[model samples]
Target: MLVEFRPHARLRGKQPADLGASVLPVVAAVSASDTDLGKVRVVCDWVQYRNNFRDVVQLRPILNGDLEIAVDVRRAADAPVGELTSALLRQSPDRVYLEDWRPGRDSCVWRFNALYWSALDLWEKATGRGYEQALPGGESDARNRAAAAELIGELFAVWDRLAASAALPDELYVIELGVGNGGQAKVFLDEFRDLDRHRGTAYYSRLRYLMCDYSAHVLDLARETVAEHTERVSSFVLDATRPRTSLGFLRYKAFLVYISNVYDNLPTDEVAQLGGRTYCVHNRACLPGEEAAELAESVSATVDELPALVHKLLRLGPVLLAEACPDHFADTDAAVRFWQDTWAALRLAERYVPLAGLDTYPLTDTLTGEALRPLLESGADVRMHVSNGAVASFVDTLGLLHPFGKLVCHDIFVDDIQGYRTTFRGPGKYDGSVVNWVNGPLLAHVGRKRGFDVDYAPFRHRAGGHVVTMTAQVRD
Candidate 1:
């Protein structure tokens, strides 16, 4: 049951007669309890909307009414005079309205229909559980556990691919942008512990995990999550859409940045600043043009080059791991065509080189043509590229061997039609990309321009889907 409120009778000035006729009756109907004149308590919260300047009021009655009343009001924390005049004109005669709402006020009405909450509700409806229930924890859930294991395995796999001639950094700062319940974080931490046992304590101690989010409520939840790890993790509250303030950049310098389900929230410039090694995951849902329009108004910039923003982020760091819903692209051929066209339109054909010699590269048996051919053959379509990672070593090698080379390695993966369907089920969907050398012969032409030695490990993998990871070293 949802209740709506409008301060303005029409669009401009309040129509007192109309309010008395239509608005008051609606409020009275919703607020009326078991008794004819039952009282309803209104909770006022200080949070205000940009367009409207009215205090949010929530009505709770002792007895259920025929209609449940929920009023959403907007007010400015700091507004000039007459801001609440229109809102005040629409007040119910018999109902008590809470005034001057602020944070920590129990009377403030909470925003219940936020996007995060909506997504949670949708997930709950799909999974047959309360939205508040914790997702698959570190143990017992085989599918989630396997996904975690695969992600951890990819970290090293990516390292091997990029570290061929370089050494691992002394410290790896990993920041997960949208860590919902820290389920994946826990799995990664567990894997790191295992690696410590096998490699050395020093290797483990040098690794730090930071989970960032926009909501203070979510940040509070993460505090408990980090507490479970006990000194192994920490959390921060941040708006990723905002620019990297001096303080933010100081806090976020790291070997890798891991963002899950956050790309849709950021503008291209913000994404570009998130350079350094980064791994991002997002669904295929296209951002509504209106939403983007609003963002542009606030940020004062149009999002004309979303793909370029992606490319910039990939190049900022040597290795990047990004995932999106395959629904964004229509099919494998469509996916290829999309990139081909995207690069052509951007006049950046020379900057991106698809990995062609996939067979010669050390690929897992599961990643073979027998496993991937069907998706290509069946015409699997996608809304966005899923499971993307960039090898910085490849980037560096291209830069060194071909000074003028601006090639970026990409691995394209399709999961629905693949034999290893287990990998696609845990997460929303699966698509893969890798650095293909056969498709990138222009490398020699570009490599001759510059030559320099870079120390990084060569990435090696037994299979394609095993791990989507990349690693690179930055020298002082």
Candidate 2:
């Protein structure tokens, strides 16, 4: 049996074969790998093996004639070796393949992600709380008053320079994507107005603040929060990934595009360079047949029918789903409850396939996978999020910036390639949405290529957190 430990640095100075020796007895007794040999992989943890493992001790079939035995080492270590081995040896009696393992970006997890935003009202109403409550501090740091003041101060200086030259536009544009509860926007606009008055400038009156988000409910809530600045605020329910498609008129006009806790939530795929071969990680979302049957039974349905019901629930929110399937769901609340349960039990099965070539892989419509080679080759065996959606959004949003403008994002960012080796960078769930650390190095590389400077610094307002401030501006 082949064993792999992750963060990979976990086995520092040790051989894979040597580190796997503890399980040799279990392997010998089962002789599970005797027939398939290298086809069997014993994975150590879930952070790196999330695609392949869901439980403390579990087994999954990799489509390419391989078997995966996944163990949560942290949880499994306390159990008797025999008990752990027995758990491993147990066949997945009701396991069912839901989708062919595909790239992380294509996984069904994202469908659930989109559902969270589209159905935000129902989810929040049913749960009696907004999604922002799920954040680390039960709120975002993007609304920090001092941070907003500093940013507004900087923008004022830029506007001041242009005003002196008689080049300032009549309508100053500041677009904020992913406006959470409008706390950040309120802070920003409040500061901008205060600063403008103090500086004796007209920039505040000239400001056009656009609040954009995927959920109309979120936008509504944010709009209400910033009601005091309603005249200056314009809200749009646009997909964050395709902002340029909606804000095309603002091309080369926006002075400040602010994004916070957003890039990390966008869809991303993961790539790994191991043993000198690069591979793209693929995943499939599935419900263990046993769990499916149980969840189905709770809803008076069958296991085989669960997947379709789920797709329906995702495409149509619980109320519509309940109305459409009266036979299964007793009411909207029941349907919403079922949706919650299913999401909690959702699992992703993952595998790595050798990349045919980097050039053939598409990073975005404009950028190709070839752009990732340098980052992937920078260190030892490493797996990192491609941040596909984030990259597309970043590059496209840059086009919306005036040459003197800037884009500032506050989110989890992996500032150095070496950071990948030392830590677990997400694909973690934030409420019902997905979160992955934005690829800082990759973003910097593309920014420089586009004649922009991208830089990162730890978020200064908060004393302890992973949030970083990424600023992209035309290179001087």
Q: What is the C-alpha RMSD of each candidate to the true structure, in Å?
A: 24.2, 3.7
User: Model 2 misses residue 358 by how many Å?
Assistant: 0.4
User: Best TM-score goes to which candidate?
Assistant: 2
Candidate 2, residue 401: the lDDT equals: 99
Instruction: Compose the digit string of candidate 2's lDDT tens values, residues 5-56.
Output: 6535555555332334335544553474344666676655535423323655
TM-score for each candidate, following the candidate numbering: 0.30, 0.90
* Residues forming the 10-long window of minimal summed lDDT in candidate 2: 14-23
Clashing pairs in 2: 51-350, 102-282, 102-283
Error of 2 at 362 (Å): 0.9
lDDT of 1 by residue, 203-284 (tens): 4576667766655555655566557565657677655433132114423244344443333222210000011111111112
Top candidate, metric lDDT: 2
